[model samples]
Target: MAEIDHIVLGARSLEEGAAFVERHLGIRPRPGGQHLGFGTHNMLLGLGRGVYLEVIAPDPAQPDPPRARPFDLDDPALRQALEAEPRLIAWVARTPVLEAVIARLGHRGGEVVAMTRGDLSWRMAFPPQRQDMDNLIPALIQWQGEGASSRLPDSHARLLQLEGEHPEVDAVRAALAERGLEEALKLRPGPHARLVARLRRADGVEVALASG
Candidate 1:
């Protein structure tokens, strides 16, 4: 069965992202190397165990990517939204049998692509276009060995729960169940799609990062 891996936060810039995290979570994220071909870079904050948060932004250091940037960073709508503040855009699920999971999800699974960041390598199942399900459906990842969280510095924060609301809640529930992800998120029906992650800080305060 697949498990919650990492959550993605979209930002206009890495500096802005780090500041936002520090303001809310009271800890700054550490630099995570750039995705060479994806034309993006990130900072990571450990969420205890093998889960973490990834703040991703366009890499001005690189030329435009051959393809559209991941997490819809190139989408004008998303870019405009990020101009205001970072958002909890999406999450990823890790599993050993990525190909099998992809086959199970069919079109919803997206195309499998191999990618690298520094010496770490992995394969991911990403949507061909913009993030699907309003970025509610977790992207699937298969790391070569240990995942990125292992190498990340502990931030004294731990993810406590993940929740989502969407117009088509039943369909979304069925899709997740097919991928053995039904237990990964607490889902409900809403006027639109949105994700929420609940976390416990070192000071024992519970905070929420919501997609808005």
Candidate 2:
């Protein structure tokens, strides 16, 4: 029953990411809730139909816990990634069954990690190391249902179907089918991370924001 809930623009700074979005799409994003445990914060733009887009970066103001950071922000590679270019580093999709999705998701980099990121109670099943960023996919989620995003009004932005240039796109679809995942979320595993969102702006012109 779940589809693509959001796209994430993994940036080094919150303002930089939001500005990139505003310049490209001509819409200002609103401040989303904070994830103190994740060591990150985000600004949000409604993508209509209960979906959204996020501009995320490490929150330097948060207290540094004695233990390791919860989200991927602490990872040096991700840090360097933003330093190089604040672009679409990764995106997450919601799954009804957390454990089941983890099992089926063909992440070549070992098992997924079960970690809590503040108010967001979810797990990030990414590559164990930084080198796998090229092949690393998305974090499947089973959100902590608390009406956090339930009451938000979504600005209707039409999402056109996705197109993939990778050869393994069929395999990816077949794998999802094997796992009982939906076909509505068209994704193709590729070398570079980019968000290909086909949406109509408020002015009724169809455009795709490469920012994710």
Candidate 3:
């Protein structure tokens, strides 16, 4: 079965993203190494139970990549949005039966592509069009060794719920069900598409992080 692996928070810079997380969740994320080919880097905060929050931004130290970066980081509109604040852009689902899942879903589930950062490695189903159901449809990932969440500093936060609104809610739900992720998130119909994640902090305060 597929389950939430991590949530993606996009930012204008790593520092900005870290600050945003600290401001809301009261915990500063630890540095996550650079994505060499993707021209990005991140910081991570554990959310307990093999789940974490990922703050990702373009790496100024890396040269321009040959292709677009993941999570639409190179998109002009998304960059403008990030200028305002870090946004909860997307979430990723982990599953051991990645190849089997891909075979069943075909192109609808995107293509499996390998990714690496320092000693970490994994393969993920990258969106075929650089976007996946308004980022509400999570990318499927399969870790090579230990999962990234296990290495993150425990922030004592726990994900309570993940919800999203989309115009094509039924189709999205069908796709998620096909991938064994129907129960990972809750969905409803709306004019515009967006994602929201509810998390409980160490001190027992509940916070909601939303994507616009």
Candidate 4:
């Protein structure tokens, strides 16, 4: 099955997004690796297993980053909304069939691209979009090549669940399918339609979904 590799946080700017997470979780995120193709960079936190939390924003310094514009930078309301409500943007999965996934996405009226930061030298694949954001869809990523940093500190916020609203739920599911992500993941929402994630930390036990 396609294992969830990360939970993405999309934002117009890193300065803002980083600050938001820190304020809520009371933990500052460190500067993460870069994505040359998508013109993106992020900060990361290990949630569990290989799964991580990535706060992604467009990087202007990249020379060959994607030609995408980025998120709703022009909309003042969008920025304000994000500053007030920094919810989970999406979730990613790791698959052995990276090429096959890319091909399927390309065929299904979507584009896929991979990027590597020269400074840190790590690679990640993402969903194609005109802007840096992909219509609230999870960007698929596959770790490639060598020198990848699996470093993460345990005993942090445990994500017990991640639930999407009515229309958004359907949209995300379809997007994953269009990008060729079925059969590898059992991500279907049940009658409760809640993403139940069990998180255990020194603080106490917590849950993300209601019925979990």
Candidate 5:
């Protein structure tokens, strides 16, 4: 069965992204390394169990990527949207048999791309055109080893739920079911595409992180 590996929060800059987490969750995220080819870097916050939160932004120190950056970071509209606030942009699901799952889903997930960050590496399957399925669909990942979640420090935040909002909730649910993730995520009909995650802090405060 597939499981959620991480949730992605996108920002115009890493500084801005980290600040958003600190301001809302009352915790700072640990530094994560850069994606060399992708020209991006991230900060990580462990959300208990094997799930984590990733704050990602383009690395100003790096040259422009050869192709468009992942998660539509290069898109002007998305960049403008992120200027207002850091938002939940994407999520990843881990599967051992990535190829079989891709085949089973009839190729909704794109070709597998090998990605590395320092000593960590994984195979990621992005969706076709990168925006199909209203961006409600999750990218698929196959970790090379134990994965980064095990090495992260606990951020004292417990992920209570992760859900999706879309106009076509039934179709999204069916796709998740095909990937064996229907039980892991709940989809509800809404006017737009969005991700909503509820996290409980150590002090008994619950916060909802939503893409808006």
Candidate 6:
């Protein structure tokens, strides 16, 4: 069965996003390398167990690529949204047999692209267009070797639950159900698409991370 892998937080800059996690969640994420072709980079924080948090942003050091960046960072609306602060933009579901899952879903999930960051590598099924499904549905992932969560230092923050709001709640639920992930993700009818993550700190304090 597919399982929640990680949540993606988008920011204008990696420094800003990492700072937000440290200040608000009381955890400092470790440096994750650049996405060569995508012109983006990330910082990662372990959410305990096999789940983690990924804060991604544009890599200023890299020259603009021919193609648009992932997570719809190049979109004007998304840029405006991030002007104030970083926001939860997407999430990933992990499955051992990614191809099978994609086939079962009739390829609505996206295309599987092999990606690498330093020693870490994985295959991600991204939507045809960056905003095709966006926050309404999750991308599929299959780790090439060991998952990043296993190597990350525990940040003392545990993921409680993940929920979302989408105008097409029924379609989203259907997709998740097809992937056998319906029970792991909760969706409600709403005007716009948004993802919410609930987490608890070691001190027993709970915090919610939402997409704006």
Indicate the worst ten consecutive residues by lDDT in candidate 2: 128-137
Candidate 2 TM-score over all chains jointly: 0.71
RMSD after Cα superposition, model 3: 1.2
Q: After superposition, how far is residue 10 of candidate 1 from its true place, in Å?
A: 0.5
**TM-score ranking, best first:** 3, 1, 5, 6, 2, 4
lDDT of 2 by residue, 153-182 (tens): 665555565333234555545534543444
User: For candidate 1, which ten residues in a row score worst on lDDT?
Assistant: 127-136
- Global CA lDDT of candidate 3, please? 0.90
Q: Over the stretch 1-212, how does candidate 4's per-residue lDDT look in tens digits?
A: 24566666667677777886666555666778666555677887666556666777767686643365333333465456556555455566666666676666564434445455653332345554432223334455566643223666653766654444332455557765665554333354344322323444435645341211
RMSD of each: 1.3, 4.2, 1.2, 5.6, 1.3, 1.6
In candidate 5, stretches whose alpha carbon ends up further than 4 angstroms from where it belongs are none
Q: What are the per-residue Cα lDDT tens digits for candidate 6 across 82-160? A: 9999988888889999988777766576777888888889998876663344565777889999998999988889989
TM-score of each: 0.96, 0.71, 0.97, 0.65, 0.96, 0.94
Clashes of 3: 0
Highest lDDT, which number? Answer: 3
Cα displacement (angstroms), candidate 6, residue 157, comes to 0.4
The segments of candidate 6 whose C-alpha lies over 4 angstroms from its true place after superposition are 130-133
Q: After TM-score superposition, what is the CA distance of residue 36 in candidate 1 from its true location, in Å?
A: 0.4
Task: Please report how far candidate 4 places residue 155 from its true position, in Å.
Answer: 4.4
Tens-place lDDT digits, model 5, residues 1-212:
79999999999999999999998889989999899989899999998879999999999989999978988888898899998999888888999999888777666768788999999999988887644565678889999998889999888788898988888888888878888888877878988888888888767899988878
Where does candidate 4 have its weakest 10-residue lDDT segment?
192-201
Clashing residue pairs in candidate 4, if any?
A: 2-184, 37-66, 70-131, 70-132, 160-197, 160-208, 161-208
**TM-score of candidate 3 to 2 decimals:** 0.97
